[model samples]
Target: MQLIFDTLTGNTRRFAHKVADLTGVEVVALADADPRAPYLLLTYTFGSGAVPESTAAFLGQHSHWLRGVVSSGSYHWGESFGRAGDVISAQYRVPYVARVNKSGNAEDVRRVADWLQTHAANAAD
Candidate 1:
């Protein structure tokens, strides 16, 4: 799995590191990802519910192989509607998991990792 993000305050990056630690996935800045690998965009939401400008630009540049986007922080009303990148997954998909926090704890990340593992295993069967 490839984790991509454009972090300004490092909060998003800090959570990405936790994801890497749990899943052993490579964490890459949006500019450093391999275009061929499946991608998960990690971005922060602004008050207007827009993805960081840098992240939006990165996504525009590499619109290929973008499996899903995971936005950190609350979104403004009508902020995240209709933004699609192949497939979209969010906290709403799995309510059992907790949202990512600045403390570097992400139940959702672990849930995603486990879900991916199960999906891969099922595919092999």
Candidate 2:
């Protein structure tokens, strides 16, 4: 599966690429993505746990192929932190792979990598 990302401050981009480097998943920007296979979306949360408009637009076309979601947000947002992933996951009935702080840490990368390895393939079925 591909790793598609939408970013405002580049944290989601950085985190998506880090996950790509570890998992060998192809990474692409939302603007360039036309996913033919399953994919995991990584995006950023905006005001009051809202999903970015660009990401919402992308999902409008591509949610059918989505297997999971991850999102990045500032930790200070607390309850709203990375809530975009939760929103997308619930709406699309896909897994909420992670909610990362900023660009994320090694542990976050590892968890995502593990999920990609173990769960992403199953999603295709």
Top TM-score model: 2
Measured on C-alpha atoms, candidate 2 has an lDDT of 0.91
Report the number of the highest-lDDT candidate: 2
Residue 64 local lDDT, model 2: 78
- Candidate 2 Cα deviation (angstroms), residue 95: 0.7
Cα lDDT of all candidates, in order?
0.56, 0.91
**Distance (Å) between predicted and true CA of 24, model 2?**
1.4
Give the Å shift of residue 16 in candidate 1: 0.8
Q: Which pairs of residues have clashing backbones in candidate 2?
A: none
How high a TM-score does candidate 2 get?
A: 0.95
How well does each candidate superpose onto the true structure, as a TM-score?
Answer: 0.67, 0.95
